[model samples]
Target: MTSNFLIFDCDGVLADTERDGHLPAFNETFEHFGAPIRWSQDDYAELLRIGGGKERLASVLTPELVKEAGLPTDPRQQRDVVLSWHAYKTARYTDMVRAGRLPGRPGVARIVAEAHDAGWGLAVASTSAEESVRAVLEHVVGPELSTHFSVFAGDDVAAKKPAPDIYQLALAQLGASSTSAIVIEDSHVGLTAALAAGLVTVVTQSSYTADEDFSGAALVVSSLGDYPADPTVVLDSPHGTAIVGHVGIDDLIRVRAAALSANSTPGR
Candidate 1:
């Protein structure tokens, strides 16, 4: 079926949350905790491959790092430290959101209003905390449109992106089937998760994800754009031809219709 639901991946897809918002927040958290740890840009870029904030924090706990940072040795204490760090990071990120530091991507607010008015089910699925997601959504689309989004984030599922758990949870909670929904994602992992759930996906490049492979995306663009001031440059498309510049809500509908048509075809 043509997509009646639109699911958004937070962070990169909604706003450029990773570089400006999240990175600083993480650094601030590390400083506040008196940990001799600070992830340089390159270091954090590698860490983004991990799913959640706590997961990312835990991933840095090698024996050397643990010793250098003087982190708790006990497993329980280690887990607690990561949790506390994540909580502080989340708060800092939310503060950044509230401060209007992260602006919505080119067409995010426009497309969201369009989708909401067209009666599409709107939602955000992410590994970030629900509070952080809400803050970013509200900051981007304002309180009214933000309310229309059903958020599935943080520890909402046992597994994170690339595992299909978060997208599956979103589909279930939105009362929609994967075939009836389209997901907008920025990272390869996010695209894989959505695709694994059987949803069509559109990729808009983000800071850290631009060079990553996005082999299965139905459409790939620099950003979901509004044209003129921030026109979108098509990076890839279903057919091997040059695509027109700038993508709006109508382009999304065409993409969804094309996906539905393809899915209905018989295959081996």
Candidate 2:
């Protein structure tokens, strides 16, 4: 049996972890390992284009860094070295999450609770490491709601986003149809992946993803909006669904409903 699904992307969507948590963790890992590779905010903004953290680390391996960091020169050995760095970084980042250094995005907790109570299939589909994603999910939505989520992350699929493999795997595991799932994503690559998998996506722009394209998202908001504290502002809404202070499960259903109707109409 299939159920309606609400899938979330871990990093930016669940919490604004990329800037405060991940970036610092990566730097700290490099420092702890004596690697001279340190990325500034602007550098990470560009690096965000890459999908997986391992890939991102691989992308920055320079001859100078290899020698200075005492990394193995052999290709296979260097791959192992990069893997170790990523593992360490994941640990550091998860620690930050467990310590509550990163705050959950505005309405993420509220929406998660509401969706769970409504019996919507909930999952997190991300390219981040499983433990890292789990840590952030638990920290943001709490240990109680986190238990209800199915997490599909890291090498769960060979291809990462901007590729649909992760989302496709999630759909299969969740026993959900494309029209029955709504994805909350915070980056252009994440949005592209969810769209390619035929799921309706909503973009809640993060610190690093505000200017990226989100033309296909059913809704694009500043944050999910937590009532009076942080009201979500619609950046782009393809379905034109009205959002009050925050987005709830009802808004998600309406968005998916509108998406289905549009796709079902003639000439669409």
Name the candidate that leads on lDDT: 2
Against the hidden reference, what TM-scores do the models get? Answer: 0.95, 0.96
Candidate 1 RMSD to the real structure: 2.0
Strongest candidate by TM-score: 2
Clashing pairs in 1: none
Candidate 1 lDDT over residue span 78-125, tens digit each: 999899889899999999999999999888999899888888899999
Q: Write the per-residue lDDT of candidate 2 for residues 1-268, one digit (tens) a residue.
A: 4377899999999999999999999999889988887899999999999999999999878888788767788999889988999999999999999988999989999999988888888999999999999999889888999999999999999899999999999988887889889999999999999989998998999999988988788889998888888888988777779899889889988988888788789998
lDDT against true structure, model 2: 0.91
Clashing residue pairs found in predicted model 2: none
List residue ranges in candidate 1 displaced over 4 A: 1-3, 240-245, 263-268
Query: Which 10 residues in a row give candidate 2 its minimum summed lDDT?
Result: 63-72
Candidate 1 has its poorest 10 consecutive residues by lDDT at 239-248
- Clash count, candidate 1: 0
